[model samples]
Target: MTQPRAVYIHVPFCAHRCGYCDFTLIAGRDDLAGAYLDALQAEIERSPLTEPLDTLFLGGGTPTQLDEPHLQRLLDLLRSAFRFSPDIEFNVEANPDGLTDAKLDALANAGVKRLSLGVQSFDDRFLSVLERRHSSESAIEAFGRCRSRFPDVSLDLIFAVPGQTLADWQHDLQTAIALQPNQVSTYGLTFEKGTTFWTRREKGQLDQADDSLERSMYGAAMDQLAAAGFEHYEISSFARPGFRCRHNQVYWNGGEYLGFGPGAASFDGGVRWQNHRSTTTWIRKVLAGEDAIGDREQLDPEASAREHLILGLRQIEGLNVAAFETQTGFALEPLGGEALSRLQDQSLLELTDDTLRLTREGRFFYDTVAADLV
Candidate 1:
């Protein structure tokens, strides 16, 4: 197998857990960070990483949750494992409340060029509802600080939040654009199972925006952001020219990547595997010189081809007809011609000589389109 061109290191430490988050994380257990780093080093040392990496991403409960020294150490350890492309887009997830000047300095010194801040909203009421620790003012300050040192800064926002109105979403988008971020990713809030928000919703303690309102809010983002000269590069992502999140594109484009740390997943040699979700279990296994992988799936060629088609369609570019055949050794139309015709008849899909792209309405029903095509 070829060497991975991208890497993702998960740092599952959070100062405080948000009510809506279902990510693999252990909030308020900052005390265990050192042990986690040690395990990370062990995993790194055991892996092979002789080729240069094009992109590197640090995601977690919050990578910025680590103290300066620990953060520095973690960055150094990961950097040492791979040869980096001269212009590697190394991104780290950060929160406004936990990013200190010292941490910024450390990140800069370690060659981190991108900061993807979790500024979920600029509305104080929404922030409180989401249980975020940072206020609107603080999040704005954090973006300013990140821009001072980083060449590329991205912001993550959520729309269709409970009790959110179209006006509220418009204001949030306006506020985000005024900040002039290199890129913005807008996601509709999801109440995943096991999250506090999910439990509250089930108990009728919390409510979600109506489906029609949710769709309208999303459509508004696409329209408003486009008017502001942002490229809707992906379904949920907008970027100023040349400012796309290359690291995430690696995943969206189905590029192979290695993942490290607890709850991280790696795809290599046609097999996808995940690490132990429990930090303690992952750390103990790594320290004991044992495999920390908990489960894996070896996908067959047909299954892999289907996945490629679905994942590729998620992008605005959709799937290139010729390239699809080259990659999967199966003509896409031959495989799903009937389904494609059905979607086209509904005006949800269109074919442009070589590219099969989603129409404007299809963007909202991408999941259905994906299922049908696959």
Candidate 2:
């Protein structure tokens, strides 16, 4: 098998857990980080690579939450495991408050070319409601500091909170564009099953934005960002001329990638698996020279084909019918030709010769379109 060209390292330490976050992590558990890194080292060395990785992404909990010494040591362990090209796109996710100048220096020294700052909103009220530690002023300040160190900086924003207004969303968009970031990812706030936000909503302690209002905000975001000269590359992502996220593209294209740390998932060949989510379990398995995978599955041919079509449509350029056939070994007609034709007639999808893509309305209801194909 060919070596995967990308790797994602999960840093599972956070100073505090936000209300809506359900990601695998241990809040306020710095002491467990050393053992976590040791387990990470073993996981990285499990499958030695003969070539350098093209892209490396350090994702969270909050990668920047690691203290100075632990941060450097984590980088050292990764460097020993895989060779990185001089021009590799090394990206790291950081919280606005913890990304101090010293942390920025450490990341730069470790060859981070891009920074994804979690600047969820420019509204202080919303930040407090979301349980985020940083203020709007501090978020912008962190962006300025990161901008000085990294070549490409991407900001993450959330919209459609329960009390958010259309004008509030517009202001957030205006403020974000003024920062002149290389990329922006605007996501609607979601209440996952296990998150605090979800439980509160279940008990009438919290509420969510209505569907109509949420849809309006999403549509406004697309138009506003486009007017600002950013390419609407993906549903939630907009980028400057040449600053698309390479690592994320790998997954969207169904390419293979290896991931490390608890709750991290890996896809190779036709199989997908995730490591144990518990920190203790992952550490014990790695230290004992045992596999850390908590679950695994082999995707069948039919399932794989459907996934390709599902993921492929996410790109702004859509799926080229001919290229899709070549890559997945199945023509579009055999898979979803009838549904596609009907949707196109309904003005939800468009088929231009060999290109199959979502129309403007279809992009808004993408989940329905994808479901129809299956």
Candidate 3:
């Protein structure tokens, strides 16, 4: 009777796909909305319910893209699946264009207490370049509306876009600060394969910022956000006190969660499963009384320990050396001795009270450091 502490629902519908997004999403599939909800409900019902969920996250394509009735139906399915904690942090991700009053009302009634808005940039030009449908004005208006409804609001921003100067990045940060969101997640643009930007780059239609410039932008964001009283809790996430994303923490801390919907990923105990990415395939399987899972992997102890190291390093709080040993039965020093020694000698890591964490400079070269450990 193992009950999940967190639940994640993937809503794969979006009005239009952003050029830079590589997430599993379907564009112009609003026609599949009804069937998708039904399948999701069926999937949840089939899942074993053993615990009250502490956190529930509705991440997307755009959860707000669903109509009122569909959204309500999904929420109802969740409520039926497991009992929610009295103080559960229910989070929903919304694009600016979809954050209408009606959607907000539906979310509020559904008990969603946190809103994570996708506001990639405050500059209109950058917005256009990023293929975001919302204008800067609309994003600001949406944030204000969300603030009036949800107790906790997080704003997502992207920095280090091609041709973006340091001043431009700083301006975006300053604008986001003025909005006074409860949390801010700043990420650098990665040219993910299969994304429009990746193809464009290959064809010389788009350029990526140089490493030095990207590093500068990252440093600037860290300094600015910290000065604004946001905790650099994770590599790309910053939050005010008591506002760190609890659902996300579950994943980073190696806890179990159940994911539902097309292209969703789930981890329970030591088994990991991913659903089919195609909306049609997912709906067909679920309607046929079969799970939509396309792949399943049962992690061995060594693989799981390596994952713990990788994910834990993403958090600024770093990994507890002793806990890592207990969880995987593999001592951190033995598994990553050479890399750890090199990093420590370079002053990129600090060991205090059986915990190993990155220094400020270490965070900048995190990819290199993480590779060494692997």
* Candidate 3 structure quality by residue, lDDT tens digits, 1-374: 57788988999999988888989889988888999988888888888677778999999899889988887778777777778889999999999986779889888888999999999999999999998889999999999999999999999999888788999999999999999999999999999998989999999999899999999999998999999999999999999999999999999888998898888889986999999998899999999998689989999887888887878888999989998888889988888878889998998888889998988999998888888876
Candidate 1 — which residues are off by over 4 angstroms? none
Candidate 1: tens digits of C-alpha lDDT, residues 220-307: 9999889988999788999999999998887777779999999999987478999999888999999999989998999887878888
Screening candidate 2 with a backbone cut-off below 3 angstroms (N, C-alpha, C), the clashing residue pairs are none
The ten-residue window of minimal lDDT in model 3 covers 73-82
lDDT of 2 by residue, 248-352 (tens): 999888899999999999999599999999888889999999989999989887788889888878887788889888888887887886887898888988889
Per-model CA lDDT versus the true structure: 0.90, 0.90, 0.90
The per-prediction CA RMSD against the true structure, in angstroms, equals: 1.1, 1.2, 1.2
| TM-score, prediction 1 | 0.98
TM-score of 3: 0.97
**Model 3 regions more than 4 Å off:** none
lDDT of 2 at 9: 90
User: Candidate 2: where are CA atoms >4 Å away?
Assistant: none
